[model samples]
Target chain A: MKAATFLAALALGAVSLAAGAAVAADGPTLAAVKQRGHLMCGGDGTRPGISAPDAKGEWGGFDVDFCRVVAAAIFGDPTKVRFIALTTVQRFPSLQSGEIDVLSRSTTHNLTRDAALGFDFSPITMYAHTALMVHKDLGVKAGKELDGASVCVPPGTSIERNIADFWQQNNIKYKPVVIDNQKELNETYLAHRCDVIANFLPGLATIRAYQAAKPEDHVILPDVLLKEPLAITFRQGDAQWKDIVSWSVYATFEAEEKGLTSKNVDAALKSKDPEIQRLLGVTADLGEKLGLPKDFVYQIVKKVGNYEEIWEKNVGKDAPLKLDRGLNKLWRDGGVLYSPPFQ
Target chain B: MVEAEARRLVPRALSLDNETVRAVVLQVATAAAIVAALYLLGTNAAHNMARQGIVSGFGFLSQEAGYDVGESWIAHSARSTYARTLVVGLLNTLYVSAVAIVLATVLGVLVGIARVSPNWLLRKVSAGYVEIFRNTPLLLQIVFWYTVMRQLPPPRRALQPIEGVFLSNRGFTHPVPTWDPAHGWMLAAAAIGIGAAIAYRRAARRHHERTGRRWPVLWPTAALVVGLPALAWLAGGSPIGLDVPRMRAFNFQGGTTHSPELVALLIALVAYIGAFIGEIVRFGIQAVGSGQREAARALGLRDGHALRLVVLPQALRIIVPPLTSQYLNLVKDSSLAVWIGYPDFVSVTNTAINQTGQAVEGIFLMMLVYLSISLSISLFMNWYNRRIGYRR
Candidate 1:
């Protein structure tokens, strides 16, 4: 009997070691984060209005707040997060390598990524579009007039491929000058090394607002090259972990729909509405199902405000980008965002 | 069987006791261990990539590479395959490196000669050039030149430094004689003329060897080369059409435009590598001793004649070896074009990697191309060095 037990134990141990080499779908990602006591968030270090580091290496932006939301939901402290700066090419690999728990780099949530790249995406964080901007003196009014023009482009992104597709579809020709550094790309475009610059709308806005010699000297064309829905990415196959991350993002959307501002969240906790009570963890065990404290949503909303506050603070009219929320607004407000019931 | 019996008498012939057998077995075992480790690591990577849903293979080479290369010598477009893009990138790399090598050699030789010249002002200036270029990082210099080039006036306000040539931030454009079939015939005539000129020089040398009579070789060679091309041009209707660049809405139309990126990368690479080549050349000329120059002067030769006749011939034997390294370095440095957005081999491969998410294959392909180019350069240089080297 003793010999049989030893042999069975040895076989089990060997099988477990072999299984550990592959990323397991049913593995405990949440437990690993909890044990580490901090969340590792991947971000684009160069995008100003999206997710960039300050002089002191403190990260702050719209996409970065989504990372804070996840951190707050798990540890009840928004500061329990470390940001790993990633380039456009490094973002997916960093997440796949388990070097980061979440990638909130304002990357486009597309079919290739969500279905094919072994990643699950949260609901759209911001509705952006790949766009083209030119020097005001170039007299380029639209994309159709871009023949034989030299364009400055950022390397290692979908925009590199998307811009090519757009030009081919229009049956026009343009020379591409691919610059990897964002600041350098903007400089090259501004110096007239290239006649035009193409990037995401928010990125173009940031460059025009901050990097240009004269803000009025450049104009962004009104052409939607591609509908870019930026979303937070997660390693796929861990359904339990995906649930926690997705709901953390939705909790902020739910808070916005309920008109729960950070200051009013404490006051709303005492409300008699059954749904509000359940959402605030006053009456239900919804948070436990996702393997969290019953008051995870409360922590998230109180620490990082609802979706509108984040957008306004980071890239809205009140911010340097001064972007208008068109398709990024709540579903009831004519936008595409909506959260399921808290129960 | 007799040899095997003799080996067996030397105690444990195949084991550690026998020196030759022990060394061979040790080497084989170590090689096997290294190869086995590499195999394990490769399979582990393949497994991890598969688990992450990354399809790993070179199958993407045949896929349509929907990208544009700014400057290419090859017939390439957005409709081309990834394989064609690699070819375009390789050709651009080869073209730029080849031009940079020739220019840098000329500039370096001049600098080296100036470094040891009789004039004090020339020596100091050449020394300063070497010091400044060699001390700073090449990346910084490339970026500096690019930035300075960007400050040139736009095409509308382009500088007309000379007739029919415009300099601008857009690019430098110059007038060219419009293409005609006559020009093609003229080129072929010039090539044949060159072959005749070389043969005439060899015959003249043989005449000198037999009768000590110096033939007028220069005039004859020049007539054969230049005169033949001129005759071909006249025979083919003497086409004189001029194609000039005119400022269009975005850029100049017609003529040839050298993009600012190409010009800046070439300038920085030549200037930087020229400094190192200058040092090598200075040492080479200095290695030809003053005694040789004195001996030539003792025979009543002029200063220029003595230095050229006595010093350079010997100096060349020393210069050829180190010169090979500078040539190789220039080829490798051309890859830095990616930093300034000049679509060299590594730059386009980076785009391919991004679009396909095939970093491993892309990096491997880049290494293979650079290795091939470097080895070819080494082979040619070695042959040239052997030809110049001394023999008993």
Candidate 2:
């Protein structure tokens, strides 16, 4: 018994020493990310046109491409990215604990997440807005008409909370059927369990396109209940890592503005124009300032194309969701998407 | 011989053979070891959480929930605090569990009796119910029932099988009486009637024991309870008014409506727990010997009276213990209501955790709530079991 207790004590002593080392060893996040070899990208795996797995277990979507762009900027290989599917509850905790290097999940960039949670958000990737999707036969055009309507909302989402807020503000009484799983919400909504399904527009559009028998049978209300600026998030203490991620998004937008695609990246690399040459890492030392490879923008363009390509490939006209590039278009294209000058 | 005698008389100065000392040392050492381990783990967690900048405290309970629940027995709004949300969720959990326990007990007793009935069909049906429900998982049953409920017609095309009632995907809506001040008097009359019946039952039992004669208390007790209440209600001008549900633009209004989620959860919980309860009841009833039944019959008592007086009284002793366990199980298992989105204690707390990012406090509160509920149920059932228990 004495020997057993001695051995247990020794083992516990070793465990505590290891735990202390783990807590004390705080290295730069960029260095750690590089050592990990692959960027750990967290996102929603169930959102169809945003980030979801296909039939062959391959994940593809808009946010998935953003992660690949980040990977390409760092390693010059888009495939060197690992996707960590996280729920709303698991997303922030996972990021805070360094389980994932970056969180590109369709999470809103808000004051609470910014100031309180110690997270630094990248530029807005998707300008999302929540709206109510109703059966076209209901003839409801706005939020005010849906008094006493049964609404199906997925739990643990901003959409559910927004529905509550909208109803309270409008003084409209409605029954909310909160399903924890989005898939089940779709099932319940398809079965007409609720009169309306309230969610973000892209999500509603995707669901209507895929889950509905007759896509035209549903109509999204004109009144958007909430504005959601979805962005990429990382732990706050690492400004260098934040700059890398933030500018990675900017490079994609800049590439699109410069009329560059994956096909023309090699051509642009040989260009004589000082601005294009500087962007492609030929004329100036821009990459050194961000602690990335000199040809990071070239790598991003070559591997994942630009913002326009990413959008069109995921949720634009060529995609199944067929969402319009309204506020997401470049500033030159009559929209709000504009990147800071690379200089 | 003298040295041996001194050693024995002196107890050998607290040697291993001293039972009290040995036990005390072993128990204290074990408790100290456990306390040390827990302390280590707790400190480690606190250190890690602090390093990660995750706030650790119970201060978030007073914050506004900024969310709404679908159904609530008490007044609740988005402006309500997180503590109030948890209370609402707890009340919802208790509401479903209490109703389920009563329904399951009644159904289980009846089915259990039917299981051993002379009629072959009834016996087979009862056995089938027990086997099917017991074999399937409770969560799957809950989900299946929810899906079935969702398949009902939409509210615009509600199925009105009877006047003053509607059934649809939205829920079941039926006429409910709008009680006025006169109803209070009627309730008082009913309470008085119940009191008088109880008094007469004791008197009748005493008279039967003293004179070896039966007193007809059943008819008189029934009349006093029902007739008095009806008379008082009429005397108070029959103020109870029916608020029939009327179909509006979207759904039914002006009546008591049971949401489809509630109906689905109730059906699933009752069916699942009723099977286990039925098995317990069958075992308890069977534990009562046939000789007891024959003894009552030999004493010239009818089958109903024999079962009621002799068989049930003995069977109850065996049933109450297991029945208490089943009751507690039912209460704990009601947390599965989250699967069908019933917003029970765990469900609301889960949302709170997700929103606030205070996983530790949310989970701790959930554990405490469930533990307290289980303890309360156990205490009440134990008290009841003791009341009906056999005395030596």
Candidate 3:
């Protein structure tokens, strides 16, 4: 079990055996997080919409807000979070070392990561595909036209293998110039070191919309090289902590499906619907099951808003990336998002 | 005499007062402490990794490396094994290190001689070069050179200073002789010519010793080398072709292209190391006393002959030992190529670690490879140092 801390307790006779036992009862990671009075969330800090700092140095994005939802549920304060900037190579190691309580980074939910890396991913947060972006002057409309092209890829990402597999299947030959950082890869692509760039579709769209010198001059090829279902990841252990994180995110979808916006949530406290009353914490204490307050869902929605609100504010039509809610809509709305009943 | 003998002895051989016994006991304790510390660290790491569910060992080397290598001499693809990727990465490291070593040595020797030159302009320029390159950080210089390379004209607007060589941001390309079976015989002739020249030089030295007559070696050696290859060309009917590069859709197609990453890495390494090596060479030349120069002058040797025959051989003895360290440093510093997207050993190993999540095994291999490379360089330089020492 928690041998490291248990040995230290035996050494110092520290904090009373009762307090140590109490910590073990709840789970090590959450108790430690609570003792620190904040949650440490880390992610790729260079991507604009997924998780990066804005012009005022404030962190705002889908991933950053998702981290806030967890924070708000636990501490009842959306501000109880510190964001640690991580590179793709640094993400898993940072999580393994306890540098971050949760990886709100937009990482793919793949089997190897789940099993081999010892990570438990939350519900699929966003669905995207690895796509290629090239300058319009290249006159290439499809990925098949990318034969003999030099492609710039961020090193150590799944995008590298995805593009390679794509090329192999199509019988096309291409050169890969793997830059370690995404920001530098964009520069190299612009410098014509590469004729095309392979990245996550949302990431490529963010680049084309914000980082590009001329947004319209570059076109993202319509090809799904690989399906990337991004999610919130945490260390694999502590079933209670997993339920807390997973259900906290599920609350967002659950609220959106129930027509419970943050603006309308308070008025819906009196609604006749039994599930809505249970979800809003007016009837049942679902939050208490995960060791939060009776109204943790209400706290999360009030402080950070629901899934639709977070998406629309971060990467939607009015946002810089202006991405559509393509596959992220609710299940009844012809998309894949659905939440289990609050009961 | 009794007191001196008593000082060395003890009441008991096993006691700490016995000098040799004390020394042995202290060394044993220190060695034991080191071994224990290392064992603890190893076990602790293993425990923590196991608890975290992270796997260990080098078994991942045989798995297919799904990523493509940037530049590799060996055959590498997404389908190749991770072990093969390592060789490709190592070859890339060795290629850059080898080229940088030779070029830095040449540049350094020239600059060192110029620093002490009789002319005012040459001395000042060399001094300025040493100061500028040595004072700044090598990493900054690499990035500066990369940015400079990126600013060059695109492939379509490449600057051609010669008929066949093209220069662009993509990289420099020059016309190379196309492959032919006849060229293989020419290469073989060149190899034989080199062997013949070495024998002729030794024979000429023997003749000089016997007759006190200087046999012309340079002209004869050059004639044999060139004459053999020319004869082979004539016998093979003189087939020749040039693979010239021209503009294509995305990049130059025919001739070999040196990517900007390689060019930038070379310039940065050569310039930075050349400055340090220049100081070593300068101190080495100065270490040869004025007495040696005078002795050669007493024999009526001219200035060039005096410097070559007397001073250089002595200076080389001093230069080789320190030059060995610089060579080792240049090889290790090439790992910085990872930042600029050059697929050196560290760069590719980093990707492997990321993909496999086997940080321990990947890092151990990296340390092993670099350590081996440094040791080989050290050994070769030590051998040269021994050879250049004064003979009985």
TM-score of chain A of 2: 0.93
lDDT order of candidates, best first? 1, 3, 2
lDDT of 1 by residue, B137-223 (tens): 999999999998899998888998988799998778999899999999999999999999999999998998999776888799999
Candidate 3, residues B1-392, lDDT tens digits: the string is 99989875657657676666767766665565556555555665576666666777788899999989878897789999999998999999999999999999999999999888889999999999999999999889988898888788888888899987888878788888888887888999999999999999999889989996767888989988998998888898887789999788778888888888899999999999999999999998999999999989998888987987799999999899889999999999999898788889988988888788787788889999999999999988888888989888
The per-residue C-alpha lDDT of model 1 at residue B319 equals 92
Question: Which of the two candidates, 1 or 2, achieves a greater TM-score against the reference?
Answer: 2
Per residue, candidate 3 scores C-alpha lDDT tens digits across A1-343 of 2333444444344334434443343456778789999999997788787788988888888899999999999998999999999877778878876789899877888876777666788998898889999989889989988877889988777888898899999998888887787787788888877889988888888788878888998998988899999999988866887899999999999999988888998888889999988998899999999888889998889899999999998899768888989999999999999988888
How many clashes would you count in candidate 3?
0
The root-mean-square deviation over C-alpha atoms between each candidate and the true structure, in angstroms, is 5.9, 3.6, 4.9
**Backbone clashes per model, in order?**
0, 0, 0
The complex in candidate 2 yields a DockQ of 0.42
Q: Give one digit per residue, the lDDT tens place, for model 2 in A211-330.
A: 899999999889879998889988777778889998999999999999989998998888888889999899887888988898899999999999999999999988989899989998
Question: On residues B1-392, what C-alpha lDDT tens digit does candidate 2 reach at each position?
Answer: 99878656756457656655666666666666667666766677666656555667888799998888889999998889999998999999999999999999999998899988899999999999999998999989999998888888988788899997888988889998897887888899999999999999999999999998988988999988998999998998977589999888788888888988889999998998899889988988899999999999999999988998899988888888888888888888888887677888888888887667677678889889888988998898788888888787
Could you give the interface RMSD of each candidate, to one decimal? 7.9, 3.2, 7.8
TM per candidate: 0.90, 0.91, 0.92
In candidate 1, stretches whose alpha carbon ends up further than 4 angstroms from where it belongs are A1-36, A96-98, B1-19, B197-227, B295-310
Task: Flag clash pairs in model 2.
Answer: none
* Cα lDDT, all candidates: 0.86, 0.85, 0.86
